[model samples]
Structure formats: structure tokens, C-alpha cells
Target: MTITCQEILKTHEHLWQEATVHPFLDGCKQGTITPEQFNTWLVQDYQFVVEFTRMLARILSVAPRHHFDVLLGGLTALKDELNWFQVKAAERNLSLDVSKQRTCEEYSQFLESFARTPYAVQATGLWAVELAYNQGWQLPGHIPEPYTEFADRWGNLGFTDYVKLLEQQADEMLGNASPDIQKEAEETVITVAQFEKAFWQMAFNAT
Candidate 1:
């Protein structure tokens, strides 16, 4: 049986589960995560998002002409997301001036490595990163106060739909790719999943 890109991704669903259902997310859901830890995550994530926005722009630059609108939408969302992070950090008295944690830095490096890759590879990495967050917060349960906004930011139906669109775009791009490119895209997805897990663990441990 031929494996679709989505099916290839499903093979690594365990990593997604490990990332999204992590203890940190559990703490957010139950309001048990300490203020310091939450702040740490916010600061580190803000840094990551800054790099993430750059990554999006990089991808947008190389995106096929037909895919410009979708990629541009993502870039616009990142700009808005960055603004939200700044406002929320101020409201919570958390400084956004903090440095990126080791995990975040490494993830940024991983993203940078895709700078010159094919569209399929880039889309696969981007899709994996977004899907991890969408699935993580969309986990079935009542999201507690404070964290509710955070959950809605990434886990809402609108975002979920957006992710699905990106997934489809990736699959379509991969459809005509060479076998070697397809394998590279799969590796990118797996690496993204692992990085996502590490990112959450970094937040949980406040390391």
C-alpha cells in the first residue's frame, strides 16, 4: 500500500502525544504550573517565536508562486502571535528580554538548516511544528483559566483547520517529489517531533 505523507506522519504520532500531553501541558490545564516555570516558558517561547517568524519568512521566500497566499497567511499570523506574546508577557509581569534556552536555540538551528531545502521538506517541518502545538492544546479537557487563552491561541478550530490546509499543501507538494526528497521530508517531520518533545520538557523542568 502506498503511504501518503500524512500517513507517514501518523507513524510518528507517539512523539506528538509525548509532546502535547506532557506534564507541562497537564500543569497548564490544572493551573499547577508555577509562575516561574510559566514565565520561563513564555520568555523562551517568545524567543523561539521570533526565530520561528524568521523561519516562516524564509520559507515564504522560497515557496512556490501558487503557495504564496497560504505561506503569507502564516507569516501574518506569526506577526500577530508575536504581538500577543508581548502583551501577555507584560500583563503577567514576565520580561520578554530573556535569552532562548538551549532547547529553543537548538530548535532554531534545526529550522535554519532548512533554509535552502525544497518546498516539501520545508512544509513538512513547518507542518509538524504547527500540528504539534495544535494537537497538544486541543487535547480533550477543560482548559483552566489564564491558560485558556493560550490554549485557544493554538488549539482552536480555526487554527486546526489552518494546520490541515498546510498538511494538504505539504502532501500535494510531496506528491511529485523524488523518493530521496520524500525521505528527507519524513526525517524532517521526525526531527521536528523530537524537538517539540524536548521543548515541552524544557518548559516542565524549567531548565
Candidate 2:
């Protein structure tokens, strides 16, 4: 009985697609997003990464021993990623200390709640969240300037490869879990998709 993330993704097919290709990404591709709007994502997402990195560290601590190497790589990349976000924000004169918008705050709180879930749930949710960004930025059509570099940051081959690695690890975790844990993990993926969609929408709609 090998359960898979693909099964969960297919279970919520419409939501999976919507979460990854929402209007915000469409705006990004068309270069319709203003600098202020971009700042909303930059500031909020940097904050989200901080919490997400913490969650990855927690997930690493409890994940199966064989999964450590990949989780460690994720943690390391996040350290560099935090720095990358800082540099990008500074270059654009965006402040990173602003208050988290409602969606961002709720998402951060949600990530923290993973402390109570099984490793399967944590790992699967993490994979789903990353997949959304990878898909969103990798969308067809030219991404205008500044946004092009950001797109490359997440949508590039390297990042896509990394996300694939994560998907494999998460699926492996889910496959070996108990029936209850597997079901919880699948539900967690759906929750992550909902949050991903909201996070993107938050950026585009923020005043």
C-alpha cells in the first residue's frame, strides 16, 4: 500500500492548479504588478520563510534517519535563501520589518502548528507548499524585468530539481506511514494548497 503525493494532488486537482496558477502569478507574468505590490510579497514572504525554515528544522529533527540528508540540504538552502531575500529587498528599497498581512500571519501560525503533526504530515505539507511556488513562477510567457530574476530564483532548473527531490522524500515518508497518518498527510497537502493560493492573492490584493 504505497500512498503518494500525486494521489493527494490528484484528489484536489482543481485546487492544486488554482493554488499554483492564480491571478497574482498571471499579473507577475504580464508585468502588471507595481513595485509596491511586489514589495508586499517580498516582505511577507521573507517573514514566511523564517517560520518555514523553523518548521523544516523541526521536521528534520523527527523525520526518519535516512531522510536527514535531504532535510539538511533544505535547511541549508533556507539559510542562503533568507540572505537572498534580504539582498533583493534591500536592492528594491523594500523594508522587511513591516507587519505581516492577515494571510501571512495566519499562514505563519499554521506552520507553527505542525509541531503537533506526524512527520508524514509535516513533510507532505512542506512539499506541497514548495511545489506551488515552483509551478507558479515557472508558468509560460515572459516575465518582465526584476520579476525575471525572481522567477529564475524559484522557477529555474535547479529549484525545480530540488522540489522534485523533496517530493520524492515526502512521498517516501507517506508511503511507510500508518493509514491514519497517510490520510492526515493528504489532508495537510490540501491545507497547504489553500494557504499557498491565499498567500499569492494576498500580495496582489494588498493595498
TM-scores of the candidates in the order shown = 0.95, 0.95
Question: Which ten-residue region of model 1 has the weakest summed lDDT?
Answer: 1-10
Model 2 residue runs over 4 Å out of place are none
Candidate 1: count the clashes.
Answer: 0
How good is model 2 by TM-score? 0.95
Clashing pairs in 1: none
Residue-level lDDT of model 1, residues 93-154, one tens digit each, is: 88788778889999999989989789888988888899889988889466888888988999
Q: Choose the strongest candidate by lDDT.
A: 2
